[model samples]
Target: MSVSTDLTPPAVILDKPQMAENIGAVARVMANFGLTDLRLVSPRDGWPQERAWATASGADWVLEGVRVFDSVGEAIADLKTVFATTARPRETRQPVRTPRESSRILYDDTASGLKTGLLFGGERAGLETTDIALCAGIVTIPIDPKHHSLNLAQAVAINAYEWRTLILDAPPPRFRDSDPPASNDLLIGMYEHLEEELENGGFFYPPEKKRSMSQNLRVMLGRAAFSEQEVATMRGAIHALARGRGRVLAKLAAERAKASSSSEPPRGE
Candidate 1:
């Protein structure tokens, strides 16, 4: 059986969203969490923003399928269940639940063959009281009390991450690592070669900090966890720099010897 048959993502509704960039970011976060549906109600700058498409990066698919509405009522008109996301307490007596709880409810509703939607408010102002009343419940994220403000796209990302992780079983992140990390011996050789060049260039000034600087350099390189190919590249770069420095130093020594010979008086007479 196909996984799509068993799972249905909730409709993500943005009500009176102000900025086109924020809308684009919401689309990006939605794609990150395997969400696709995007609904807009009365955007300030109008629909089909060139800015939004540019900011979406490669998530043009979400923006392409966007459904525009005149109001929240019209946005989720056909949906039987909906949740409004807000930061503060609403005047309406709607049940307020955490993102996880709201996502769980949505999962249950969608699993049982019911249409569902998630409501988001404008960037400056959250969901209006009337909008909250339309939703069956409110999803509130518990953030630090000192600084509770969350940007429009950030709010979408948080709620979307919760729903995707708790309900949809999001997949692992993709990565590529063909070769193992470089050996310690290779790292030390690279460090020594680079440090010697840096010493010639007087990078470690004041003399007292050279030891600590060396240790810090090693620490920094150690954290890179460089692959064999990356290490090889770095080593090659360092060798080129060192070779250039050697040539310069040799030229300077030759010039100094010529000056000394010219200044010395003839002594064989």
Candidate 2:
């Protein structure tokens, strides 16, 4: 019934996990190493289940507070550094490290108050190439190459144990250093403002093409969660262009009015 104090509690992310029992077992493993903060990204089995809680047993706290997200990006939205746990290499070319090495790094960064997370793919197919690429690093447990497959909860337990071994002797946890980017309201406002300006500038015009154009623009901007300062600067640029276009239109309208009046044959003769 002992827990490791050296391991930093990670925000454990499970991507499309299949079984509720496996999820509960993972929670138990996390509890064994003093790790909590479970996050589920599109779990195949609906969460907050009695089956999972029953499996978790003494680790009910972890299972009770498990967070659910729609996507991997949303799951780790607040994390500064994330390590992906996978058995196979994928599209991501990030340096692969063993569980022990990853644990040491996680301990160091967590001690310095950096929000870090670890991602575990699903049971059957594992993580997709795109899912792997979303993480900053990859952690693979060293096992026999002849038969290297591991159960979902087993993988979680192994990593959690390694993390605990690394940080057990460190000092108390420190304050987190950085904060997440702007809130959703701020980002949505920026998107709307930019969309309006683009419409005014004839960038997203032709009426028929507006839908696709706006969607593409949203997708591009949405990917790079801009900082507060970046959002402010972008908003300023859009406003400047909009104001400039407004002035030019006003000037053109005045010129047209004056020309039409002057050419009216001296007030209808």
Write model 2 residue lDDT over 173-201, tens digit each, in one string.
44544454454446567877987788767
Model 1 TM-score on a 0 to 1 scale = 0.60
In model 1, the Cα lDDT at residue 203 comes to 97
Model 2 Cα shift for residue 71 (angstroms) = 0.6
* C-alpha lDDT of all candidate models, in order: 0.78, 0.77
Q: What's the TM for model 2? A: 0.65
Please estimate how well model 1 matches the true structure, expressed as its whole-model Cα lDDT. Answer: 0.78
**Runs in model 2 with CA error above 4 Å?**
1-8, 171-269
Task: Give candidate 1 misplaced runs (Cα > 4 Å).
Answer: 1-5, 167-269
Evaluate model 2: give its lDDT: 0.77
* Ten contiguous residues minimizing lDDT sum, candidate 1: 170-179
